[model samples]
Each structure stands twice: as structure tokens, then as C-alpha cells.
Target chain A: MLRVENLSAWYGEARVLRDVALRVDAGEVVTLVGRNGAGKTTVLRCLMGLHAGQRGTVELDGRDIGRLPTHRRARLGLGWVPDDRGSYASLSVAEQLTLPPVLRPRSSAERTGLAWSLERVFEAFPVLYQRRSVPASTLSGGEQQMLALARVLRMGARLLLCDEPTEGLSPLLVTQVGDILRQAKRHGVTVLLVEQNLRFATEVADRHYLLAQGAVAEALDNSAVRSRERELLAYLGI
Target chain B: MTGFLQNTFNGLVSGAFYALLALGLAVIFGMLRVVNFAHGAFYMLGAFGAYVLLAEAGVSFWWALLLMPIGLALFGMLLERAVVHRLGRLDPLYNFLFTFGLTLILQDVVKSRYGVQSSPYATPAELSGSVDLGLFDFPTYRVFILVFAVAVCALVWWLLSHTRVGVVVRAATERPELTRAFGIDVGRWVTPVFGFGVGLAGLAGVLAAPMRAVNPLMGADLIIVVFAVVVIGGLGSIFGSVAAGFGIGLVQSWGEAYAPPIVAQTLVFIVMAAVLLLRPAGLFGREESAA
Candidate 1:
């Protein structure tokens, strides 16, 4: 489980996230739906300790990791898939996959139950396996996204934090990503997603937190999001 | 033709030194993003380290060659921890200035101590004699330098490409944030990497002590040529540094033999300018992505 309380972040003098609070329980796919500059990505960055100017408490599994460094947070089982897909240009797909040393497992069950191997990742994204020896930069946008996701999974991340994983992806690839998220949920991987695509977010996420102007505006269950789809779309200005 | 062969061979020996120095520069620049103006100073210190070990400690040249780099490497680590690491978040120019100042201080210290004269380092007895290579008789020491430089370069390349440490280093080189995100303590590698690079510079210094006049200003003279070599090869490129080091060495030698002295003196810069005009990224440098 992850909990963020009164998270306030800034870029120099410009405050970007103000008193933003959100939480995600284990085995749930939660999404932060927002417009551009709604502080969703900033939220993720703050959580990952990538935002140096952030002030708040970020608790991962009841442990305060706010003061921990980015790498330390990662070693504590937090995996990030950035909006840019953050693939090393010179590294081959196989190299990228194998580069991350698996962090120490959170629990004994995590060690045995969630042993996501390279073979499993390869099986999930067959195209990645096909282009395993090729440089990640040579891959298509969709393939790069898949490689990004696959790499984090191979690192044995328990809590996956994704930023726009479906952005710029084709509908077919988006569907494939959705299936992968569903598969991940079944395997008990907690996901906190920042998404622009409400339709895709609703499909994959069990609950959604709509963000506006650097703060959480609404929290809705999957059924509430579906019933209030038109109202939510208008609120989100979609 | 025999004269040409002899000059070419001589060029290669000098090139080996250039390659060694440039390789260190490349590695330091690749990891730390520091220009490391003190690299030349480090090289000078390496040579002096050997000289001191021999004169004061009663150590032999062979043992100095083996032990001096390790000693200098520790010195380099201390330098990083004390000075270079502090400037990590500052503008790269701060690092440049800091290193430049360190270079001056180091040069002054050495000059004050040793009186700025070229000191002769005796070649090891095993490598003192000349070897006939059919085309010409070559100093056994020069041949040892060539073989040793190549072997070191090869080992470095293998370490960067094949080893897990290398993978982490390469990843950190390309994307530090992402590398850290993979749970690697990239900061922990910085000190050692800096020391390693400095050690290489020291190793070159030790190697050069026997061949060149070991002097206070030796590194100062060679650093410029090494910089030119790094530029022509591609800044921060491992392969480019080595190839360009050797290539420029050969070119410089050939020019010395064939071209006028003044023209030969400026030939390396001319080649560097030409390479820049043709490919601004150098032979092996990748164009940086637009921010």
C-alpha cells in the first residue's frame, strides 16, 4: 500500500502540487486522471523522490520513504515508467531488461509468489523478445513502452508507478497494455497510474482520483466513474 | 622507406602514451561530465610518484609501475571525495575552474620541489636492450609500451562491454536518473570511477617516465595534445579516444618527418579543425538530443 499526505511540490519559485493527497491499497489499479499540468506527473515524481523541492510524507507499506533517495525508494520495490518511456538509446532490449538488479523482496510470499522473470516479461511482450538484441531506440513507440514496463517488472517491483504508459500508443497497443495491467493486477502488483485517457483508465483501474490545478478534486469507484462518465468528462474538459 | 617505417614505429610508441592519457580523459568525461583539467597534473604526479618511490623508498621501476597507480588511485579518490564531488550540482564550468586551479597548484608544487628540470628515469634492465623487428631495430622498452598500452586498452574495453560493473557504468553514463531508478547506487560508483580514470593517467605517467623526460611540466605539455586527440576522436567516446590517439600519433610522426617543423607543430590542430568541420560530433560522438 502507498499513501501520500498533503504533498506540496514546487519547481523553483513556482508551486506545482499543493496539498495533494491520495492513497492506493494493495492489489488495486488506481489512476490519477487529470488535464495537462494537473500535477499528476509531479505527483509521481514527488513519490519517486525525483522532485527535490517536494514537502510531504510518502509512505510505502507504512514505512516513511519521503527522505529516502530515488534509488533507495526503487530498492524498496517502487518501479517507475516515465512519460518519455526512459529507454537507454544504446542498450539492447535484452540488456535493458537484465540491467536492473532485482531489489530485495518485501516479503517471503513476494519472493515466491511474484517472481517475475525475463521469460515471463518476454512472454507478455513477444515483440520485445523478437527485438531482444536490438537497441531500444530502434523500437517503435509501443515497443518502447512495453520494454519500459517489462524492464521494471523484471526488476521485481511490487508497486508499479506509471506515467502515461498508453500515451502516443496505438489503440491495439493500448488494448495490449490494458491486458498487461490486468494480468499484473491478478499477480497482486499495486499500480498507481497517471493517465490522460479516461476510457482506458476506467477499463484498467479499479478506482480513479480526478485531479485539477494541483489538487485531488474527486475520488470515484469504477461503477461511479461509469455512471457519471458524461459529468466526469465535462469536469475533466475532455 | 626504412626511415618512414622507423618514424611510423616511433610515432606508434608516442601514440600509445597519448591513447593511455586520452582514455582516462574519455572515461572521466563520460562519467563525471567534468573536463578534468587536473588530468595532466595527475599524470605528472604519477611520474613523480614513481620517481619518489625509486629515489626515497628504494623501490625499483617494475614495482613502481605496479604500485604507483594504486597509490595515485587512492589519491584520486581522496581528491574526488574532497573536491570534485562537492561541485556535482554546480555548473560544469565550476568543475573546470576548480580542476584548472588544482593543475596550477600541483604544477607549482612539483616545480618548487623538483626545480622544473627534466629527470631521466632508467629503463628496467629487462627492457633496456633493442630488439630487431626485421624492418628495423627497436628499443625493447618502446615495444613493451606499445604492447602494454594495447593490452590495457583492450582490458578496459572488455570491462566496459562485458562486465556487470560496466553495464551499470554505461547505463549511468547515458541516463543517471533511470540508472538510479533501477536501484543502483550510482553515487557510490563515482569515487571509484574517478580514481580509476586518474589511475589510468598515473599509469600513463609511469609508463612515460622511461620514454620521455620526466619533468614537472610534462603533463602540461601532453594534456593539450591529448585534448586535441579527444576532440578529433569524439569527446567521451572510449573507442574514439584510443583510435584518435594512435591515429594522431602516426600523423604527428609522419608530419615531423615529411612536413616543415612549423607546419608539423600545427598539424594536429588543423586535422582537428577539419574533423570538426566535416562532423561536428567528432568521428564517434553522438549528437546530443535537443533539450
Candidate 2:
């Protein structure tokens, strides 16, 4: 479970996320839907401690993690797949997967470990196994996305914060990503997604929040996406 | 035939120094992305470290060889954490500026401590004698330098290529953020890697101490030549550094033996200019950067 309250993040002088509040119970798949420049990515970044001017209380499992450095947060089971994929072009897929310092779970932390292996990820996306030896820069857009996800998962992430997961992929690949998200949810990994695609969000997310400017404009369960259609449409300007 | 053989032997010995110095530069450059103006100073200190260990610590040549590099490496780690880490976010030029100032400070400190007069660094009793190889005799020290330098290069190449921690370091060197996302603390690695790279420079200094004059100005004199070697090889390529180091060493050595002694130093610069003109990125520089 995670709790972020009264979070205001900034990049230089411009405020991106102002007084943003959100919460997710354990294993919840929450999609943040808004148009371009909706402060969703800023929220995720602020939580990860990448944004220095972020005034926030980002509590993970009831403990404050706002001030920890990015790597320490990662060890605490936060996986981030940035919008650019942040691919290390020189490294191979296999090298990326098995490379980092693996965090051994403590006695209480053992409950947080999800059972997913490299082979399982390869099975989920066979393209990864097929191009396992290929350098990441050579990967297609969709394959790179898969690699980005697989790499974070390999790092033993409990909460997956994906920024624009479906941004540049084909519809088929988008569906594949949706399947991957569904599978991630089934395995009890919480997902906080920033998405522009309403259809993809509706397909994968159980809970949805609409962000406008820098605040959480609306919070809707999956059913309200259809039920509260006018409110969602008005906010999205669709 | 004897003259040719002697020149060839001399070339290899000089190449060993090139390889040793360039190897240190490449490792630090790859990891830190800092041009390290102070590296030459570190290399100088390595020689000084050996000199002091022998003269002041009452240590023997062999023992100084073992301890000096490690001592310089620790010194390098402290420098990284205290000064270099503070300038991480600034333009890399700031780092160069900072290091340049540090270099001046180091050079002055050493000069004040031990006067500019070149201190003698004698070869140990065991390695002082020359060995006969059928046709002619070769100094034991020069042969040892060639063998040891190549062995160190091989060890470094193997460490970077095969080890798990090395793989992590290599990956992080290329992409720091992605490495961080993988739970690898680059903050922890950067200091030590910087230290190790400085340690290599120190080791090279210790290696050179017996071969050259040990003085404060030694670093300033040799660093420019090492930079030439790095440029001729390509900026950050380890393999290129190795090949260019040895190649330039041979060319310069041969030039000194056959050509005018006054132009021997200039010959290395001339080769560097030619490499820049022909390839621009040196032989092994990354193609993307060349364009």
C-alpha cells in the first residue's frame, strides 16, 4: 500500500504537481488518465525522489520514503519505467536483467517478494528471449518497452510506477502491454500508471484518477469510467 | 641487427609506460566522465609515494612497489568523495577546472616538501643486473617493465570484460540512471572506481620511479605525453589505449634512436596530429562521437 498526500512537485520555478493526493491499497492497479502535460509523470517522479523541490509525504507501507535517494527507493521495492525507456544502449537484454545488486528480503520483507524469473518474463514476451543477446538500442519500440518492464521486475519491484507505457507502441503491442499489466496485477504487484489512452486505461486499470493541471481532478472506480462519463469527458476535454 | 634489436626493446619498454598510464586514464574517464587534469599529479605522486616509502619510511624498493599504488588509490578515493562528487551536476568543464586547480596544489605541495631537483630512484639490487639473451644483454628492469605492464593491462582488460561487478560498473559507466533503477548504488561505486583508476596511475608511477627521475615536476612533464597517448588511441577505448600506447611508444623510441634526439618528443605529437587529421576520433574512438 502507498499514500501520497498534499504533494506539490516542481521543475525549477514551474509547479507541475500541486497539492496532489492519492492512495492505493495493496495490489491495486490505478491508472492516472489525463491529456499531455497532466502532471502524472511529475507525481511518479516526485514519489521516486528524483524531483528535489517536491514537498510531499510519500508513504510506502506506512513509512516515509520521500527523502531516500532513487537507488535506495528501488531497493525498497519501487520499480520505475520512465517515458523514454532509459535504455542503456550498450548493454544486452540478458545483462540488463541479471546485472544489479539483488536485494535480499529481510524476515518481514519476505512477504513482498514476487515470484517472477527471467524465464517467466521471457515466456511472457518471447521476443525478449529471441533477442536476449541483442543490445537494447537495437530493440523495436515494443520490445524496448518489454525490456524496460522486465528489467524493473528483475530488480524485485513491489510497486510498479510506469510513465506512459503505451505511448509509442502499436495497437497489438499495446494489447500485449495491457496483458503484461494484467499479469503484473494478478501477481499482486501494485501499479501506478500514467496514461493518455483512455481505452487502454479502462482495459487494464481497476481504479482511475483524472489529473488536470497539477491536481487530482477526479477519482473513479472502473464502473464509473462509463457511469460518470460526462465528468471524465469534461475533465479530459475529449 | 644489434641496433635494430636494441631500439625494438627500448620501444617496448616505453610502450609499457604508455599502456600503464593510458589504462588508468581510460578507466577513470569511462566511469567518472571527468577529464581528470589531476591524473598526471596522481601519477606523479605514485612515483613520490614510492620515493618517500623508500627514503622516509625505510621501505625497500620491492615493498614500496607493493604499498605505493595502494596508498595513492586511497588518496584518490578521498579526492573523489571530497571534491569530485560535489561537481557531479555541473558541466564537466567545471570538473576539469577543479582538477586543474587540484593539480597545481598537488605539484606545489610536493615541490615545497621535496625540492625540484630530480631525486635518484635506483633499481633494487636484485633487478639492477642485466640479463644476457644470446646475442646481447638487456637490462633486467626494462624487461621487467615490459612484462609487468602487459600483465597489468591484461588483468585490467579481464576484470572489465568478465567479472559481474565489473559488468555493473561498465553498465553504469554507460548509463547511470538505469543502473540506479536496478538497485545498483552508483554513488558507492564511483568513489572506489575512481580510486582504483588512481591506484593504477600510482602503480604506473611506482613502476616508472625506478626508470625515471623522481621529482615534483615529473607528473606535469609526463601527463602531457599520457594525454597524447590517450588521444592517439581514441578517448575512452581500453583496447585502443593499449594498442596506441604501445604503438606510439615504439614509434617514439625508434625516432629517438634513428632521428634527431631534439625531434623525438615532437614525433609523438606529430603522430597524434596525423591520427586527428585522418580519423579525427583516433583509431578506436566511438564512431558516433567522431561525427
Candidate 3:
């Protein structure tokens, strides 16, 4: 249940996202697929209110949150999994999970047991528990990605804005991430992913928005995305 | 070896100030990502505030110790709001340059009024005498300084690890943007944290007023060493800054004991160079730039 219209973002004089529009329904897994510099990350950043220079109205569950700060957006149920896998040097693995306060569901219908306890997070990713006391910076790439995903889920985010969750991850880790996404979707979490991996995107996402040069080129269901996978890969130059 | 314990004790006494000042630096850098060249000026203000309190208002040591930090915290918060936050969006070097300019102004303002002479401040009569140690007697105030510094460090450690405020502050300090995206109002913490960091520096200055020459240049000289201490300890790590502060003090003291005066002054820098060459992240720091 997120909607954006006439969203245009810029980096100084250069227009990165020009009048782009997209939507995602509640409990659905959606992806924005595009080539490098297609403004996928900017869209996520704008939705989170981190990108300052933008003109857009981001509606979450029929509420316009376009003017809210990043933290306010987060508290409103948007869980951000950044591309770099936000990890702090001073924070231990356990501290990272517990840092973000869990968001309470505003409506009874929104509750789908997606709110996870620390124990639940540990159960889902035992490696995090094993490395609980160590500095989060010490974790490997795959582990860091898991930590980022697990951190947002632990915070009870109803909507997940994930950026390249599988980038630089191994094949096994990619599979694990896909499973986690599927599981999240099953539990009624609405995820808007920015992914380059077409196969991975098709597997985890129900709908796809293909972005080309800062605008939405096509909105395709899973079948169309699967059928046009090779052409899309060539378009993305992957 | 003949006077190892005595030297160590002396080293720790000076180390106490480095530890306190470095703690503030670490915290401020973690949050603001600014080098804060004006931190020394704040320390000078603390000592000056205490001196002025005594000279102008007949306030005693006990009151000055209690009041200087609070007053400085308010002033610090005001400064943060008025000037520092404006430079936040630009390259970090702009703030660095601004603070550097601020330092010169602060130093000159004090100099214009009080002149460049070192002002004398009497240690509280209660802590003036020497204390009996098993091996050798040490000045009561020096012992108090060491013990009090350790206690403050411990209190800060406990507060950071055990309290809810500490966790939020720590998270925001270490990773501001990410913490915000996690639903934390990180901006709310910035001013207070800066105030707290400045208050810590002021507190150290209050303590120094009785022990060292109360002069504008005092902080300037001490801050150079403290900067080395911060680097050696790692940039934003609280524990690293404190530990490196004390460790560098010991190195400098031992150098003074066995080597020449110039060597003693440069010893901390030498150690810093070695630490940098070996561990670029400092002893306890993470490799990534904080946030």
C-alpha cells in the first residue's frame, strides 16, 4: 500500500529521476529493476526522506508522508535495508539488532506476526547469535547482509525498502535472502526491492517495474518478467 | 627502574587530563564528524570560567567544579545551534576551518582581557598536602586527579553500556543516517550530545585550573597531545581514546625520565606514528569511517 506520483529527483543540475511513478500493494513483493544509474537507489532514498533534493509525494497506507523526516518515515513502518548493509564499528552484533525500537502496528489488520523478538531473529539467523558479542564490522559480506535484513525485521517494519540485498552475496546467500523475502511476504510484509539480478528478482517478486533512464518504462507481472529475462539482462548490460 | 613507580604515578596524573579531553573528542567526532579544533578553546573557557568565578564573584573551588561544566554545556549547545549545524552539510573541512578560526578568536578574546600571562589558581586547601604511599609519598591533589579521572571514565563506560539513553546516543553517534532510518530522531540528540562533549572538556579544564597554569595557550598545547591521543586510540572509539590517552602519557613520562626533554615532548607523536603505520584504524577502532 504505497504510491508515488510525479516523483522527480536531482543531483545538482542533473535530473536523476524525472517524473517517475510506481505503486505497490500491501503484502506484495515488488521490485524495481533497471541498469546502473537508473535512479533505483534514489527512489528508495527519497521514500526514506534521506535524499533532500526531490519533488514527490510518497503515500504509505493512504497517508502522505512526503514531508516527514527519515526517522519519522522509519517509525511509520518503513524498514530500510541499505545497499551497503549499514553496520557500525562501535556496535556489537546484538546492539545492532536492538538499536532500532520496534514499530507498533497502527491497525489490527496490519499485524501478521511480522514483529520479531531478538530470540526470533537469532533463530532465523544463528550466525548473528554466534557473533552477537563481536563488533558488527567483523562480519563477512554475507553475514552483514543478513544482519541488515534481520535488523529491519526486528524493528517490526510493515514496509521494507530494500536496495540490492543480494549484491555481492554468494549464490547460497542469495538463496537465503530469497527465502527470507518469501517468508516476509508470507507474513504480510510489503517489500519494494531495487535489484539488478533478474532471476533473483523474478523469484522473490510478484510484480516488477522496469526503469530506464530515470523513468518507469514498463510495469510487468511475474510471467512477463520471466519471459523477457534475457532481453532485460541485455538491456541492463549484465 | 630506581623510581619506576614514581614515574608511573606522575605519568598517570597527566594522563588523566588527556583521557578526559580525548573522551570528549571521541564522542564529538562520532556524532558531528567534525575535528573540533575549538575543543581546546572550550577547555580554556572552563578553566577561565572557574578563574573568573573565583576572581569576580568569590566562588570557591567546590562551586566552580560543580557549575563550570553546566554553564559550558549550555554555551556549547548554543554554539552548536547557532554555527556548527550550518556547516554540517558542506565538506567536513569547512567546519574544521570554522573551528580553527573560532579558536583564534576565543584565545585572543581571553588574551585581550587577561593578557597572555599564566594565571595562578590555588588547589583546595583540603587536597593540598601529600598522601602516604607505601613506596613514596605523592601529592594529595595528584592522587585525587588520577582516582577521579578513573572514576569518571568508569561512570561514562557504565552509562554508555547500561543505560537506554546511552544506547540511543551511541547508535546515533556512530551511525546518524542509519539510526534515523531505523525510526530514531537522531537530530534531537545532536545538540545535547555536542553539549555533553563540550561539558566533558570543560570539566577537565576545571580540574586542570588548580594543577596547571591557567592560560589560553594551555589548552592549545594540551590539545595537540590530545589529538595524537585520539588518533592513536582510533578516531571515534571512546575506549580507544581514553586508553591511548593514558598510554601516551606513560610513554611521554618514561621518555622524560630516561631521555631528553625534546624527546619527551615528541615521544607521543612517535608512538602515534607507529600505531598509524601498524593499525590505521587505531588500536580499538573499526576500519570504516564512522557512519
Candidate 4:
């Protein structure tokens, strides 16, 4: 449901994304796999129009979203979870959940079809419910990640762009996140995840694109990813 | 007992001004994240607008009160669009410096035009006389100022707490990106919100026109005290700003009444320093950086 072609981005005279191209069909989970600083996160940011200086064609269901601001893109149903979590320190877990509900598109069906409510999000991560009124800063890394996911889920977002969802979490929590991703797939949410973890990427990602030196070094479908493991490792230097 | 009542009444009256000015500052700072050095200038503009309406247009005090904020808000929008909006993505210090410079220019312009002398703003004919309090007599103008100030505060509180527009503004103040992501064109809101803040400042200035001196430097000294109020209120906390503004105003009034006049002006600063030393976040302020 999303197409990005010839997408190039830069950060202050340094070219980060060079002629990168990717696509995701409805209900598919796509992964951008790369080591630290492979321009994977930049791809998600550019797609969301978060990058101030981006040039390319980003189409969501055949509409040009390249020139739209981040908010405009969000209103158009693009949900972004940055690598930093982007949590407002002053907002409580509940406040953060309630925040973006006001920014959704003007469709009644969209609002009613929300499978992720405060209760549902809490069910997904019981710890979040326990600390619903607690401020974001006091939450642990795993809890913050859960809050981030819960927040996006609360947005009723059709497309999800998650950056390093498992970077700093414990292995146990990472597994829990993997389970959440599996659950998201069941709900028909398109996910574009940026990950350095091969096991984590393979666990949920339906298709994988290995990025190296600002270009896509390898594109492996879910089945091809397993057989081409050697090629992926060489590019990743894992 | 009479003296105590008089002091309390006096404190409340002054507190009203503090509350109104601080409220505007809080709103502006909350949305813009820039310390508005020109807030007092807007306040001064309101006084001038009131004077102009009364002297030139022969308008009543009530009409000037209503029209001045709207006018100043529009002017504030122009300033925000032309100046403050450009400062976005730059160091916040640039906006602060720019506002500080604007204040000097505005004050100088007003001074050149109007002269550095207090102008008389007559109390409205309807509320011109005093009502007898049980123990002492209070002027009708003072009562009007106090009651209208409270009403304005309540109106502001209602506008901020109850409205959908307020929700968007407050949400933007807390997290601009998230608010934007949620489909709020924060850029569109910035100009109006900034203008509204300046309008509030002008409203406060109009209110003060009858009560205090209306001159070029009228807002100058008060601006410093208002900054102290902002600091004591903790940057951009709305209710904190209101409470601190009034609380400090009362404290200053009490200090001026009981203590030596020489040290009375210093009392507000003392309270601010104490609040900073003890509860650095101000009374109602949240720890924004941590979140």
C-alpha cells in the first residue's frame, strides 16, 4: 500500500540515503536490516516526511506524500516510531495514548475499528496498564518501547514505521516485542521495521532489504532470507 | 482588623494584574518555547490602544477593553508571522534577543509619539462610584478592576481547559511533533496562538490603564516582575503561572504595606530566589526534560 522510489536524503552535507527504493503491500511486514548507520532509519523518516531535506516519490495508495509535512503525512495515516522513542516526558502513559487520537482522519469507521484501546494496549503489555498514570521518563527501556508501540497502536495507524524496536531491550522483552509484531500482522497493519538483529528481523519481517553504504546491498524475501543467510552476514559483517 | 482587611483587599487587586500578565506569558511560552521579552510591550500597547480609543474615537472604557485585545492580537500575529516564525529551528536565544530588541523599539516609538508621561484613563461612568465594604470604603474603579480581572482569568481558564482549540494548543506546547503527527497543522496555529497571547497581554494593559500609570515605561518595571513570576511559576505551566502571578502580587502588596518601602520591591525577587532554591520547578511546573 506504500511505494518509495529513488528516495534520497541527507544530513548536513552528508548523503545518508542514496537512490533507495522499497515497497510494502497491504498487510505485509517489511524489514530494512542494516548495522549501525546503514541509512535504514533515514528511510523510515523520509517516508514519514520527518526529514527536512528529502527528495523522492513517496506514494501511499497512489498519492504523492513527498512534499507533505510530518503532520500532514500522519493525518494521511502514516505512523512513525522513531529510534529515540520520541516520548514526551511530561505526558503520562495515558496522556500519550490519548494525544494522537485527536489527529486521526475524519472517518467514523476508522475510529470504531480501533482494535487497540487503552485496555487492549494494557493487555498487550500489562506493565503499561500498571503504570498508566506514571510519567514516561520513569519507565524502563522495555516499558518505554511498549508505550511507544501502544501509542502508535492508539493512533489507529494503518502503516507502522518502527526504528530499532529492539535495540536496547532485554532478550526476554525483545521476544515479547516479536510477539507483539506477530499480533500486529494479524490485525493487518503494514509494518516497516528497521532492525540490526537478524533473528529478530527474521522472526516477524515478511521481506528483508539489507542496506549498506547508503544503498540496498541485498533484497531477500522471507524464504530467500534463510538460504541467503551467508550473503546477508557478509554485508552486515555479523 | 480594618487595616488587615484593607491589606488583603489591596493584595487581591494587585494579584489580579499579576495573574493576568503571567497567564499570557505562560500561554506564549508554552506554545512557542521562547521567553517573550516583548510581552510587556504588548501590555503597553494595550494601554495605548485604550488611550487612543478613549481620546480619539471617543469610545467607552468597556468597548476599548473588548477591542484592544483583538487589535493587539492581530498585531501580535503579524509579529509572530514576520519575526518569530522565521526564528523557528534556530537557537531559541535568537528569538529572545529579537524580542528584547523589539521591546526597545516599541517602547521608544510609543515614547516618541506619546511622551514618557502618564495619561489619564477615566473609570467608566457606570462603575465610577465606590461601594461600601462593611469596615472600609473601596473605590468602584478598584472593585471593577478586581472583579473584571477575576472574570478575565476565569474566561481564560475556560477557553484553555474546555475548548477543542485549547486542547490542540496545549498539546502542541507539550509535544509539537506528536501534535503535528496527530494531524494538527501547528504552523497554522502558531500565528493565531502567538497573536492571542499578545492580545491577552494587551487586555491586561487595558485593564491596568485605569488602575496604574499609562506611560512608555509603564510595562518596563512590571516586565521584570512578570519574568520573575514566570520563573517562579516554572517556565510554561498555565495554572502555575496564574497562581504564582497572583501569589507574588499579594506577597508584594503585603510587603509594601507592612515592610519598609525600600525593600518592598525586592520582596518579589526574594520569593522567586527562594522558590528557585527550594522547588526549582516552580509550584505547578512538571519536569519537562526528564519526560
Compare candidates 3 and 4 on DockQ and give the better one. Answer: 3
Off by over 4 Å in 3: A108-114, B289-291
**Which parts of model 2 are misplaced by more than 4 Å?**
A104-112, A220-238, B1-9, B55-58, B87-97, B128-138, B231-240, B254-291
lDDT of 1 by residue, B1-291 (tens): 889999999899889989999999888888888888999999998898888888888889889888878988899899999989999789889999999999999999999999888887889899999999998899999999999999999999999888888888888887888788888899999899999999999999999888888889999999999999999999878899999999999999999999999999999999999999998989988776562
Give a tens-digit lDDT track for model 4, residues A1-238.
9998988888989999888888899899989998778898788878877777778899999888898888878877777787888776656777677767534444776556543776788877889888988778799888888888888887778888999999889999999989988888898778999988887888898898888877887788877877777877776777
Better by lDDT, candidate 4 or 3: 3
What local lDDT score does residue B213 receive in model 3, on the 0 to 100 scale? Answer: 97
TM-score of 1: 0.95
Predicted structure with the largest TM-score when compared to the true one: 1
Tell me the tens digit of each residue's lDDT in model 2 across A185-234: 88878999998777788889888988989999889887889776676677
In candidate 4, list every pair of residues with a backbone clash. Answer: A89-B291, A103-B182
Sort the candidates on lDDT, descending order: 3, 1, 2, 4
Ordered from best to worst DockQ, the candidate numbers read 3, 1, 2, 4
Q: Residue A191 in candidate 1 has what lDDT?
A: 97
Worst 10 residues of 1 chain B by lDDT: B282-291
Q: Is the docking of candidate 1 incorrect, acceptable, medium or high quality?
A: medium
Q: What is the C-alpha interface RMSD of model 2?
A: 1.5
TM-score of the second chain for every model: 0.98, 0.94, 0.97, 0.96
**DockQ computed for model 2 against the true two-chain complex using alpha carbons:** 0.52
Which residue pairs in candidate 3 collide?
A: A1-A25, A1-A26
DockQ, all candidates in order: 0.76, 0.52, 0.79, 0.45
Residues B6-120, model 4: lDDT tens digits: 8888888888887888888888888888789999999998998899889998988889889999999999899898989899779999999999999999999999999998999
lDDT of 3 by residue, A1-238 (tens): 8999999999999999988899999999999999999999999999999987899778998999999989998988999999889987677889889888887778797664467899989999999999999998799999999999999999988899999999999999999999999998888889999999999998999999999999999999989988887888899999
- Model 3 chain B poorest ten-residue lDDT run: B282-291
